[model samples]
Target chain A: MDFATLLQILDSALRLATPLLLACLAGLFSERAGIFDIGLEGKMLAAAFFSAAYAYITGSVWLGLAAGCIASMVLAGIHGLASITFRGNQLISGVAINFLAAGLTVLIAQNWFEQGGRTPALEGAARFQNITLPFSETLAPVPVIGPIYSQVISGHSALVYIALLAVPATWYILFRTRFGLRLRAVGENPAAVDTSGVSVTGLRFAAVLICGFLCGLAGAYLATGLSANFVKDMSAGRGFIALAALIFAKWRPWHALGACFLFGLLEAFGNRFQNLSVLGVDVPVQLMQALPYVLTVVILAGFVGKAIPPRAGGAPYVKER
Target chain B: MPKWVDVALIPLINLALALAVSMLVILWIGESPFEALAIMVKGAVGSAYGWGYTLYYTTNFIFTGLAVAVAFHARLFNIGGEGQAALGGLGVALVCLAVPWPHWTLALPAAIVGGALFGAAWAAIPAWLQARRGSHIVITTIMFNFIAQALLVYLLVGPLKASGMSPETAPFPDGAALPTAHDIAPWLGFRPSAPLNISFLLALVACAGVWLLIWRTRLGYEIRAFGHSEPAAVYAGIHPTWIIMATMLISGALAGCMAINSVMGEAERLVINSVQGAGFVGIAVALMGRSHPVGVLLAALLFGMLYQGGAELEFEMPAISREMIIVIQALVILFTGALDNMVRMPIEKFYDARRLARQRNGRGTGVAAE
Candidate 1:
């Protein structure tokens, strides 16, 4: 492939990676707090629909983002009420929430728009436009660094930059803050945290709510930023892919960005070359699409490196006293 | 306080709550919920035609629900039912297409064996991973689901595709066709086109078999023992790996058997997306049924009605789409499975107070409540 083609692929990869990166960070927080949320996909889907719908109605992207975030947070709150307060099985609650979001989005969309569960395409102010950074015109003359900086890095929606920025912010919050220490302690040993007079429930809820907010940003990016409107099931298993990326990252903030970008690059290539072959043998498009899942399974099976989860992950806490 | 309350009354109340939510949703969409209900009941069970479709759908749910319940008994969440069912469908297609037998009686047995084996094999890797490698079965099984989807697509459009451009195989051999409800009992005056088949009977037999295995056998005891407490079970000389592997195999086999209803009985061919979302619906059924075979049967029937009725509901009222069924199913799962204690707590408090009052009045403990 030519350098231009490679740069173009990287640009799309950056765009695609934005949503996955945000969603991965979302899972990182929730899972780090011992709240294993399989509802990430559902929240993203619901948020995508609401964001697009509100953006179309008000012709304001900011309002759409707000609506999307609220929708996701509401789902997360329901999850907390079930898994945290009621002490129900976390997996079952996650499954229920996913179905709720999946069904509600399509049902409401069909009822409101009659457009087969899709919002009308956003125009002008309802959509996020790509921003080209300064000195791109002058930077074009420079060799390798110019195109990589200007073309590949500069031209993306604001959400892309935000997602990239969130990685470092996530690192700082999780590893360098007192709240982060308490959050990790809760996930690892809630009974210990409880004995210390820290509210385990409170910390977990904070983590889950933050998860919702990040997922909301991911969904909003999917609908208005990456594309102009919401399509039914447009998240398209990205939430699960993000979850897989979380596992691949060993639940670390910085590692999550690398994992998501790798998956995104694979996706970009799969999109670009359906029939391209390096060897004499034919490669099917489906195999390319299935690679991430297969790779994750291998990783999970411990053939590569160990990817252990939090000590108390997927368990509902009960007071020892 | 009573076993009967847990088995019957609690689920019934939860179901009521779910239906109530559905009603509100219908109202929100500017449709009359009562009229919609009437239409759904009529469309799902008022006629033999509707019953046929409902029972047909019920058969599939029974297999999938039992599949989930079996794994759940061993404390394993087999969320990969959708993928397992697809692979089972692949097995059915292979067996049915392999030979031109003169009778379905012969074909059915071969298909069952093939389907079960394929389903079990598909689950084996994930189970082994959880058993020996300490990998999370939940994540691996889910990944296997995506892989299964891709594999099915690859097989269909490549080696398995028929003469047409469509990504499905040609019909199974004529002899492999199972008898429909109308064929079995023409005196009932059912339409020949009704999809209900002998697979419904097979589903009941499987349910009975599962009930026997779970409650009447030693392996069942071990599974229950492991689920209740792994450390205790391990101390009792039961191997955790053995229980996990055996339970998952049975679960996958049952899930795979669902293809017999949709593929061999009705479609008579291997098709893309044939399982649709029936596999996921099994989770709701298993949860609502409390993972008991009898409960699974009842829950599967209710869902079947929802499936058939929701189709009719959409036909009668465009305002309420078919996706409305999923919403109702979700509510049912949420109330019955996740927020079960929400209702359980208040009921427990009320029952406890009444019991204490009765005891204080010198009524014996075993007396039935008036």
Candidate 2:
């Protein structure tokens, strides 16, 4: 492939990786606090639909993004109420939220848009544009890897940069902050944290709400950054993929960032292979589509050495008398 | 009140809560909530034909529910029922079309056995991975669902494509089709056109078989013991790992039965999308049934009513969105999971009060005698 094309592919890979990165990081926070947040997909889906709908109505992408975050936070609040406050089973509550989001999004979309799904196509102003990094254009004429650096590293939506920024930020917050220590303590042993006068429920609820905000951004990125409009089920197992990444990363933010990129690269390569009919060894489109999921299984089975989830990951915490 | 009455009250409260949530959703869509609910009820159990269709759908759910419940009994979640059922349907379809069996008795059993084996094999991969590699079953099963969908799509469109047709297999031979009671519909006083068949009877038999296996057999004891406390089971020399694998195989076999409904009983052909979402719905059914065989059967029938009723709502009440059914299902699960815990305290208090009253009465009688 030409250098320009290679650069284009890399750029596309990074852009595609943004949503998974953000969502995986979001999951990292909640799960690190010992809550299994399977509802990430549902939160993202709900946010994406609402964002696109708001964008379609007000012609303001900013408002749409804000609305998306608010919608996701609301979902997170409900999850927190059920699983954290009421001490319900985290897995079941997460599943319920997923079902609720899946059904509610479709119902409301059908009601308002009058289409089974899908809002109107968005205009350029309503979508985020690529940022041209300084000196990149002039540097593009140099060598074989120049175009790769220029295209892949230079022009992209703001979310890509933000996602990259989140890795270190999450690390700093998780390992270097008092709040992070408290969150971890709550997850590992709520009673101990309670004895120390730290409110376990409050900390976990905050962690979940933070997850909601991040997931909302991830959803907005999908709808407004990656595509012009939202499609039904468009979040489409990405949440699960993010969860896999969290496990594969062993619940560490920087590791999860790497895992998300790897998954994103597999997806991008799968798409590339679909277009190539190599010497009568053409792969079926469906198989190409299934490649990432297969790779996820293989990696988790073989390479994810040992997953040590939070000590209290799915256990409901109740105060001991 | 009676103990059975107390037991019944929880589910009823859950149902009522779910209904109230669904009504709010219906009202949000600018439809009369009462009218929409009326349509759902009328469509589900209002007529004999409706009952038949409900049973037909329930057959698949019962099989899948049993699959999930059996796995839950071993403390293993078999989320791969989606993939297993797909693989099962593929097995049945391939055998029905490719194998030559002159007798119906032989062909039918062969098809079912083929399906069960395929389903079992599909589930065994995840089970093996989990047992050996420390991989979580939930992630593995979710990944397997995507793989199965891709494999089915590839097979349907490529090698198994019925000549000159769409992406589906050819129809099964007469020997393979499950004998339906539709021909005897007139004598049975039911609609002649209903799609109800012998699969419903097979499902009921399977339910009874599962109940017997779970309650009456040594293996069932091992499975339940493992579920209740894995460490204790291991201490008791039950080999919890092997039991888990065996439970997955049994669950897969039950899911395979669901394939018979689609491949041999209903469609008589392998549609690539035939598995639908029944496998996931089975999880909800198992949970609502509290992982009991009889409870799974009842829960499956209730879901079947929802499915049949949802379709009718679309036809009868044009203004009501058919997707309301999914909303209601979500609410049911929410209530089932939440209300289950919510009722525990109250029920315990009631029983404690009854015990205290009996103790007071006994003391008074003793004192009077003295």
Candidate 3:
């Protein structure tokens, strides 16, 4: 491929990677805090619908972002209430949340807009616009790095930058703070954390809510940044892919970024090339889309080293008293 | 609490809560909740037509529910029902189209084996991963669901499409079509052409077989023992790998058998999205049914009614919409599966209190008599 084509592909990869990156980081926090969240897909779906609807009504992308986050947070709260306070099975609760979001988003959209469960398209300031980084115009004359810097890196929507920024921020929060220490402690052994006078329930809830916020951002980016309107089941299986990425990353923040980007690059490649030929045999694009999931299965199956989950993940913490 | 209460009352209460929440949602939409409920009930059971659709859906659910329940018996979450059911459809298509059979009687048995085998084969990889490699079945199964969908799309668009505009295989030979409710129930004076077919009977047979396998067989005892306490089962010399593989194989086979209803019975050809979320719905059904064959049947019927009735609501109300039905179903799952203890613990406490009072009364009377 030409250098321009390569740059275009890389550009598309970054855009596609943004939502997955945010979501992978979101899962990192939840899983590290001992909460297994399969409902990431659902939360993102709900946020996408809500953000689009609100942005169309209020004519402000910022308001749309807020609405999306709040909607995601509500679902997250329900997940916490069920799995934590009620001490229900975490996996079952997550599955129910997914069902709830999938249904509720479309139902509410159908009722309010009456356009077959889709929100009105946002325009102008209601949608996220691509940003041109500083010195991009002057740097155009530079040889190898000019197009890479301007075309590939500079012209992404604001959310892409935020998602990229979140990786380092998440790493800092997870590894360099007292709260992070307590959170890791809770995941590995809640009993020890509880004996240390830290509230395991509290730490876990915080982690889950933080996950909700990040998922909200991911969803908002999908609806308002990637596209101008919300489509039914538009998140598709990205949430699940993010989960796969989280597992592939071994629940680390920086590793999550790398995993999500790799998956995103595959998706971009699939989008660019509908079919590819390998050694004179035709390979369909579906196979390309399925590659990440196949790799995740392989990783989990210990073809590589085993990917261990947090010790106390998927179980509610109950005091021995 | 008694076992019966645990089995019956808890699910019933949860179902009531889910319906009540659904009613409130209808009210929020500025519709009469009572009228909506009335419409749903009348639509689902008022006519043979409604019953036909409901039963057709019920048949699909029974297969998938039994698939999940059998796996649950061995403490395995076979979430690959979606993938398995999809592959089952492929199996049915291959068998029905391989040769024009003179009779469905012969085609049916071959289709059953094909569907079961394909479903089991799809699940085998994940089962092996879990049994030997300690990979989580839930993740692998979910990933497989996406892979299965992609596979179906690729085949239908390329190899399976029958010189038509749509991405679906050609209709099977007439003889391969299973007898619908209109055909079989004529002697019983039942009319109204619904998709309901002889597969309903097959579903019931599967249920009975599952009940026998789970309760009457030694394998059932081993599965239950393994589920309840894995360490104890291992100490007792049960092989974990063997149990996991065996349970998942049965689960996948049952899930695959669902294609008999949708592919061979209703559609008479393989079509994309023929499974239509029934695999996921089976999770809720198995949960509400407490993983018992009888319970699965009952739960399947309830969901079948919801689905049929939900379609009716869409036609009548227009405001309630189809997605609302999904919300209602989600509420049911949330209450019955996740928040089950919200109702169970209170009832348990009530029963404990009653037992204590009865014991005190008996002891006091004995002292007085002495």
Interface RMSD of structure candidate 1 (Å): 0.9
All candidates: TM-score of chain A = 0.98, 0.93, 0.99
Ranking by DockQ: 1, 3, 2
lDDT of each: 0.92, 0.82, 0.91
Q: Write the per-residue lDDT of candidate 3 for residues B45-157, one digit (tens) a residue.
A: 98888888989999999999999999889988888899999999999899999999899999999999999999998889999999999999999999999999999999999
Weakest 10 consecutive residues of candidate 2 chain A by summed lDDT: A269-278
Which residue pairs of candidate 3 clash? none
- Per-residue CA lDDT of candidate 2, range A1-321, in tens? 775666666777788789999999999889888788888999999899888889879888888888999999998987887777767667667777777888788778878887766777889768777788888888888786567667788888887898899999999998999999998887788889999888888899999999999999999999988999888888988887788778778899888888888878767766676655658777677776676677667766776466767898877788878
lDDT of candidate 2 over B1-370, digit per residue (tens): 3456455667677778888988988887888888877887899899887887888889889989999999888878777788889999998888889875576577778888888888888888788777777677777887888899989999998889888768998888877767666654556656756767777888899889899989899999999998899889989999856887888889888887788887778888899878877887787788788788788888999999999999999898665556677777777777776445665556767766776776688854433332
Candidate 1: stretches off by over 4 Å: B353-370
Candidate 2 residue B117 Cα shift, in angstroms, is 1.4
- State the displacement of the C-alpha of residue A103, model 1, in Å, after optimal TM-score superposition: 1.0
In terms of docking quality, model 2 is medium
- Model 3 C-alpha RMSD to native: 2.2
Interface RMSD of each: 0.9, 2.1, 0.8
List the candidate 3 regions with Cα displacement exceeding 4 Å.
B187-192, B355-370
Fnat per predicted structure, each in turn: 0.80, 0.52, 0.75
Ranking by lDDT: 1, 3, 2
Q: What DockQ, on C-alphas, does every prediction get?
A: 0.83, 0.58, 0.83
How would you encode candidate 1's per-residue C-alpha lDDT over A138-192 as one tens digit per residue? 8988999999999899988889999999999999998999999989888899999
In TM-score terms, candidate 3 sits at 0.98
